[model samples]
Target: MSHSVASPSPKLSSWTHTIGASLEPWINLTRVSRFAGTMLVFWPYAWSLTMTARSANLPVARFFYLLFCGFIGASLSHSAGCVWNDILDRDFDRQVERTKGRPIAAGKISVPSAVAFLWAHLGIMLWMVRDVNSLAFKIALVTMFPLAGLYPLMKRITYWPQAWLGISMNAGVLMAWAFITGSIPASAFVLMGGTWAWTIWYDTIYACQDKKDDVKAGVKSTALLFGNSIKLVLALFASLMMSALVVVGRLNGHDLPYFLLSVVGGSIYLAVQLYAVDTDSPKSCWAAFHRNGFNLGALIWAGFLADYIWAAQGPALVDFARGVAVGW
Candidate 1:
C-alpha cells in the first residue's frame, strides 16, 4: 500500500492569511508584542501585593493567585491604554518619525476599529478584576477614564505629558494596594509618588527619543522641557524614588534585605543606566528606558519577595542557615 500526503486547502490558507492580516494591526496598535511597558505597569502591582501579603499574613497560595491576577490586569489595561493613545494621537503620530509607522498612523487600522479594540481590552480588564475588593474596583473604574481618556490629550496641551503618563501608569499601584488591604494606606500613596517619580525619570529618557520629532510636530514633552537640564532632573527624580522606597520599607517594616536589594541595588542599577544614557542619542534613550523594567523593577520585586519569605518562614530558617555556615 502506498500512502500520499495531503496538501493544505486553498480555502484554509486564505482564511489563515485573512485572520493574520486582520489581527496584525490590532496587535501593533496595542503594542502587546513589546512587553517593556506591560512589565513596567505590572511591577508596582506586584510590589504592592507582596508588601500587603507580608503585612496581612495572607496565605502564600493566595498571594500568588492575586499576583497572577494583577499581572493579567496590568497587561490588559496597559494595552488598552496604548490603543487609546494611538487612536487619539493618530494625527500627531503620523507627523512623528518614530511613530509614523504605528498601525493607526500608517492607516493599517482605522480609528473606529482601534476604538472597538480598546473597548474589548477594557471589557476583559473589568472582567478580570470583577471579584476584587469594591474599593479596588471603584478605583480601577476611575483610573480607566483619566488614563484612557485624558493621557492622550496631555501631549497636545502640556509639556508635562510624561507626568500624566506617570500618573496613568502608577494608578495600578493604588489599585493593587486597595485590592489587598481593602483600603488605600499612607504607604501606598508614598509608593505611588515614588512610582510617579520613577516614571518621570524613565519616560523622560524615552521621550528623548522623539524630542526632535516632537518639536517638528508641535508636541510638548518633559524631554524638551528639561533640555540641557535633563540629566539633573532625572537624577532628582531618581533620588526621590529611592528615598520614597526607603520610607515605604520602613512603613511596612521590611527587613535589612529589603533595603539592600530594593533600595541600594535598585539605585545602583538606575545609576548605571543614568551614567550610560546620552540624551541626544535615541538609541541610548531607548535602551535606558527599557532597562528600567528589568533592572530596577526586578531588584525591587526581589527585595519584596525576600522579605515576604523571611516573614512567612520565620527566624528559624535564618538560624538554621547560620548554623550550617558555622558548621562548614
Candidate 2:
C-alpha cells in the first residue's frame, strides 16, 4: 500500500553493509535493540515474583536469583515470540507502512533463517529453565506454542488480537509463580488478569499508530474496531486493570506500599496516559506505549519490590544497621 509492493530488501549502504549488515538482520529479527517490548515481558515476572516471594518469606539472596532468572526467561520468550511473529507476518508486514522494512518482511532474511533463529532462542529458554520445577517448565513450554506462537494470525481473523496478546504476553505471571511456589493460586490468576487488561490498554494505544496503514494493508485491530470510541474503551480496560491490581493486593495482604504506590500510583499514571495520548498522532501513540513499559510499569513493580523486601528482610536489615552504628 505504501512504497513498493512486497519484495526483497535492498542492500544496506556501503559502510553499514561492510560493518554491521551481517549481524543486523539477526539483531533486528529479535528486536533486541528495542528494550521496551522486552521490559513489557519482564514486568509481569517481576511483579509476580516480588509479590509471591513475600508470602513465601523467601530469603533476599534467593529472591534476587529468581528475579534475575525471570528476566533472562522473559528476554528469551519475548525474542522468540518476535521472531515467530515476524516469520508469520512477513507478507502482511511488507504492505504496512510502519513495518515494511522489518527484517523478515523486507526479505533481509528467509523464513527458514528466522525459524532457525527462533529455535535458538527457544533452546536457550529450555536450558535456562531446566532447573525450574516440573510444573513451571511445562507451563513455560505451553506458552511457546499456541499462546504466543499463534498470535500473529489473530490479526488476520479478529479485531481483538490484543486480547489474545493480553493473555500470552503476561503469562510470565503464571510461569514465575509456578517457578517459585510450584503452584498457581487464585491470586496469580487474578494478577495475571490485571496484567492482561493492562496489555490490552497499552497495545491498543500502540495499534492506534498503524490504524491508517493497517486498514490499507487489510489488517484488523482494536484501533479500527473501537474507532472514535477508542479512548472510552481503553479507559474501561485501564479501570479494570487497576481494579484487578487492588483486588490482588487485598487477597495477598500486601502492605501500605503496594496499595499506595502500585494501586494508587498506577491509577494516577493511567489517568495521565488517558489524558495525554492523542491516538491520531503516531508520535504521541509511540510515546504513550513507551511510558507503559518504563514509567507506569516501574511504579507498579517498585511497590511490589518494596513491600517484599521490607516484609522478607526488614528485621535482619535493622539488626545489621544497628551493628554498623555500634561499630562506628
Which one wins on lDDT?
A: 2
In model 2, the worst 10-residue window by lDDT is: 6-15
* TM-score against native, each model: 0.93, 0.90
Count of residue pairs whose backbone atoms collide, per candidate: 0, 0
lDDT per prediction? Answer: 0.88, 0.89
In candidate 1, what are the lDDT values of residues 235-255, reduced to their tens digit? 999999999999999998999
Top candidate on TM-score is 1
Candidate 2, residues 54-167: lDDT per residue as tens digits? 998888899899888888888888889889988888888888888999988888899887888888888888788788899998888778787898899999999999999988
Candidate 1: residue 80 Cα off by (Å):
0.6
Any residue pairs clashing in model 1, and if so which? none
> Which regions in candidate 1 have their CA more than 4 angstroms from the true location?
1-15, 322-328
TM-score of 2: 0.90
